[model samples]
Each structure stands twice: as structure tokens, then as C-alpha cells.
Target chain A: MDPDRQSELNALRPDLLRFARLQLRDAGAAEDAVQETLLAALTGSHRFESRSSYKTWLISILRNKIVDTIRSQSRELSASSLADDDAGDDLLDDALFDRRGHWQASARPGRWGDPEASFEQQQFWNVFEACLDRLPAKTARVFMMREFLGLETEEICKETGISSSNCWVVLHRARLGLRTCLETNWFAGAGT
Target chain B: MLSCQRATELMSQEQDRPLSLAERFGLRLHVLICAGCNNYRRQMAVLRAACRRFGSLGGQ
Candidate 1:
């Protein structure tokens, strides 16, 4: 590889690893994804298009690889059963609030106080990660890309090949799911 | 008047930006009549604030 291209790959390696870890949810799979991405980049140098930034182009490639991996694994492990269990759990928890279907009120201003308080609480992150892990694959991916990685909606739409409405829907569902999970599991005893 | 589900949906969007004129009007009318929706709005505001603060910590 040329020196410039080699340096570029090095610069992107950490981000690529981080992206892969979130997408795959396994350190081993992340390592493999990074290796595959770098190998592809090195061999496909001639095909590099100048229309987009190198980082974006490489990320586009990595996203495809991640999706391909997910799809293949999904075929091997029936997602329907997993989805059914998750849906059932959500439904059961929904029943716990009240007959009127109201749960703890939505988050309000001056209630939770400083946002950093939640961030500084390590327990919150643990619960947050657990809640994230429970999301369905596509929803989790969209949520992580948008929320955790701080990717723009447009970039998420492009990377996922989803329409704007679909992206919003996915994010909506993910947020609702996480909110319900946190309330039920983490804040159950806290005064509402 | 917006139903609770409709209000909830609108509230979700409001987390990202100020409600649209229609949404604002609907939300206002709903909250005026429905204490539940008012609480829902407050809940969403708190959630957004918490998320903005806590989300970065996990990313790091």
C-alpha cells in the first residue's frame, strides 16, 4: 500500500473497530470485521471514488459488511422466536402500570435535574447497555448509530438504506423501548 | 383533541425540536384537558435531558 493510503487506513482503524464492536456486539466479530474492512480497502484501492471522503466511503463498505453478517446470522438463528419473546416481555410489562394504561409520567424538566447526573452514574450506563442489548437487531443498529455514535440522521439513512420515515420510526421504537425498559427495571422503586 | 397515543407520538417528535404549529396546538389543547398528556410532555422533556447528558458517558 502507498504511504498516504496506509496512513489513512491507520487513522480510520480505531473508529472502524468501534463501529464494528457496536454492530457485532462481540469483540471477536469486531476484530474480524476490521480485518475484512482493511483488507478490502487495501485491495480495492483502484476502485476508490473521489466523490466522497475516504472515511465515508470506507464506512459505507463496512456498513454493508455488517448488514451482510447480520442477515446471514439471522438466517441461521430464527429471529421470529427471539422477536416473539421480546414482544411478549414488552406486553407483559405494559400491563403493570395501571388499568388506564398510564405508567410513570414521561420525563419532565427540573425533575431529573442535571443531565450529567445520569451520565456520572455508572449504574445507569450498565442498565443502558443492557437495555440496548435487548433491542431487535435493526432497531439497535439504528439507535446506536444515531444515539451512541452520534451519526447524523442523513448519514444513518444513507448507511442503512432506509428512508427518512423508516429511520425515524426505528429511532422512535428504540427510544420507547428503552424508556419502558429503564422505567420498569431500573427506576421501579424510585418515587415517580 | 388529540388522543393519548397521538399526543405521545407528537411528544416523541417534540424531543428533537419544538412542536410544529399543528402539534403545538394539539398538544396545548390536549394538555389543557388531559392531565395525563401534560405529565407525558414533562416526562419526555426529562427523558431528553437525561439522554443528552447520559448518552455521551457510555460512548466514552
Candidate 2:
């Protein structure tokens, strides 16, 4: 690889690692996935079409590593998740809603005012990433599987060893958590 | 009428599966009355769209 290409690859490590860490939820495994992805990219550097292949190409490679690790980790994954959440995803949800099942006085959702405009803003993406990171590990994993990887709900159920309803609950909590997080950290107070 | 909590759940689940007639009815009724749940529902949709965009954001 040219020195410029080598430097470029090095720059992508953090983004790739962040993605792996969230998907695998095990720091060591996440590290290994990123390492493998880098190695693959380095060896297959010739395959890249040049100019545009940077993180997009690396992400595709990383996705494979992430899915592979998830498959192998399936047997052990069940230990962390349950048919109903005991993983504290609901702990926050419980507090956000009153006993009457209404939004609390302080927790109501606020208008985001055309969120698409913020997509071009780096600060918005930063807040989005922070919100994703705030989710419980299990909740984040399930959310990514469905929303990021586009995995079917049944596929996620099989992988996580949880029931369909449980899977829905996890994803629900993730959406709620992320929505509230984005609101508090970005939309509601960002003066959007 | 569905509670805000239950309405939110239905909205979330609708992404994964089609809501039954009763669920649709309850959510439609609840959302028509409650501004908070309506906002929550819209935010969840925005959240989903943002996630799709965010997934690719790492690529750059």
C-alpha cells in the first residue's frame, strides 16, 4: 500500500472500533473484529476502487466480522438477555412514564423541527452516537441488529435466545431511550 | 383509549410487525387525543430514519 493509503486506513480505526464495540458488546472481541477487518483491508487493499472506498469499504468488511462474532457468541448471549427485560432498559422507561401510563410532566417529547436538516451537522451525529452508546448493552445490540443490520425480528430472536415479544420490548426501549436522549441532548435544548 | 405508554409500544412494534386492527384502532384513538404520544410516535419515526443514516455515517 502507498504511504498515503496506509495513513488513511489508520484514520478509520476509531470509527470501525466504535461500531464493533457496540455490536459485539465485548471490548476484547470488538478489538479483535477491528483488527481482523484492518488486516483484511490491508491485504485486500488492491481490491478497493480508490478515492471513495475508505470507511465505506472498511465498514463492509467490519460488518462481516461483527456478524460472524455474533453468530459464534450466540450460545453465550442468552445469559445476558431474558424473555422480559431485567437488563435495566425498562428501569429508565418505567421512570419516564407515570403509573397511569402517561408521559411524566418532565418527560414529554418535544418538536424536533425537521430533523433532516441536522443530518448535515457533525454535532448532531455526535449526539446520535452518544445516545446509542447510552443504551444498555443488550438493548443496543438488539436495536442495531434490527435497525442497523436490517436483521429480521425472528432472526434477532434466534440469535439472542429471547422471545418475539421480548425482542420487541428491547427494540422499543432502545427507540424510547434514543428518542429521549436525542431530545434532551440535541433537539429540545440545541435551539433547533 | 390506549395509554401513552401502550401507544408508544404499538408504534415501536409497528416497525417490526403490522399492528392488528385493535392495536391500530387504539393507537389512532390515543394519538388523536394525546399530543405527547403523537410527538413520541413522530420522534420514534425520526429516530428510525436517523439510525439508518447514522449506520452509514461511520463509513465516511
Candidate 3:
């Protein structure tokens, strides 16, 4: 590969890996997917059409690779599932709401104070991602699949082997957790 | 009438699937009366929109 091309590809690795890890939640698998994507891009460089930016092209390849990883994991017999099978539903219920079915004072979503403004600043995503990392692995994965991958709820339920209601519960918990996390770590901390 | 918690749950669930008539009514009523639920609904919108923008950003 040409020096400039190689350097550009190297620079894209971290973003690709973060995307893959968010989906796969396995560092080794994420690394393998990124490596494969880079190799594919290198060989397929001649196919570039310039219709989109080079970074966009690279991310398309990485997205497919991540999907393939998810597919393979679903097929494997006992592929060491990382999500705890016994993650009781009541855990979030008790933590987030009271018996009267209201948000516990500590867990309620606060007014984020100019959240749209935060979207303009690059620093907000770093804080957003840090908050994302704080969620339970499976919850974060489900949320990203819906919000990031644009997958249908049925697709996520099928891929993750969970019921539709269960998927909704996970997504609900994820939103609540992310809202609180961003409030505490980003918006509130920023005095917003 | 839906409680704040129930209203919020329906709001989140609405993103994933269609709500039944009862749920739709309950959410509308609760949101109309409760500023907090209304704000929560808007925040969910902001979150989803941000997620979409981040997906396009590729650097997310």
C-alpha cells in the first residue's frame, strides 16, 4: 500500500474498533474484525468510486464485518455468551423506580439543559460514550443495535435471543441509564 | 390514568413498537399534564437523533 493510504487506514482503526466493540463486546473479536476490514479495504482500493468520503467507505466495510461477527456468534454452539442469563428484571425496576411506580429521586431523568448544544461539541460524544460504557454489556449492545445499526426491534430480539417485551425492557433500561449517566457525568457536571 | 413511571415506560416502548390505543391515550394524557414526562419524551427524541447523527459520523 502507498504510505499515505496506509497512514489513513491506520488512523481509522480506533473508530472502527470502537464501533465493533460496541456491537460485539469482545475485544479479540473486534480486533479481528478491524484487521479484516483493513485488509479488505487494501485489496479493494481499486474499487473505490469516490461517491463517498474514504472514511465513510471504510466504515461501511467495518459495519458489514461487525454484522458478520454477530451472525457467527449467534450460530456457534455455546459461544461463551457474555450476558448473564439470570439478569433479573427486578434489578432495574427496584433501582430506578419506587413501589408507587415513580422514578426514584436519584434515578429520574433531569432536564439536560441544552442537550442540542452539546451535540455540536465533539467533547460531548466522549462523555456520551463514557456513559455508554457504564451500562451493562447486553443492555448497551441492544440499545446500539436499535439506535445505531437502525435494526428493527424484531431483528434485535432474534439476534439476541430475547423476547420482544424483554427487548423493550432492555431498551427502556438503557435509555434510563444513559439519560442518568449523561446527566450526572456530562450535563450536570458541566453545570448545564 | 397513567402514572409518571407508566407514561415513561410507554414512551420508551413506543420507539420500538406501536402502542395500543389505551397506551396511546394514557401517554398523551400523562404527558399533557406532566411536564416531566413531556421532557422525558423530548429527551428520548434527542437521544435517538444524536445516535443517528453519530452513526453517520462514523467516529462514534
lDDT measured at residue A53 in model 1 versus the true structure, 0 to 100: 61
Put down candidate 2 lDDT per residue, B1-60, tens digits, no spaces.
677888888999999999999999989988898888888888888888887776765422
List where candidate 1 sits over 4 angstroms from the true fold. A1-20, A32-116, A190-192, B16-19, B32-35, B45-55, B58-60
Winner on lDDT between 1 and 3 is 3
Output the better candidate (1/3) by DockQ. Answer: 3
lDDT of 3: 0.77
Interface RMSD of each: 5.6, 1.9, 2.0
Worst 10 residues of 2 chain A by lDDT: A76-85
Model 2 clash pairs are: none
In CAPRI terms, model 1 is classed as incorrect
In model 1, the Cα lDDT at residue A87 comes to: 59
Which 10-residue window in model 3 chain A sums to the lowest lDDT?
A: A77-86
Worst 10-residue lDDT window, candidate 3 chain B: B51-60
Strongest candidate by TM-score: 2
Clashing pairs in 1: A106-B43, A107-B42, A107-B43, A107-B46, A108-B42
DockQ of each: 0.21, 0.65, 0.61
Binned by DockQ into CAPRI classes (incorrect, acceptable, medium, high), candidate 2 is medium
Each model's lDDT: 0.62, 0.80, 0.77
Clash numbers, per candidate: 5, 0, 0
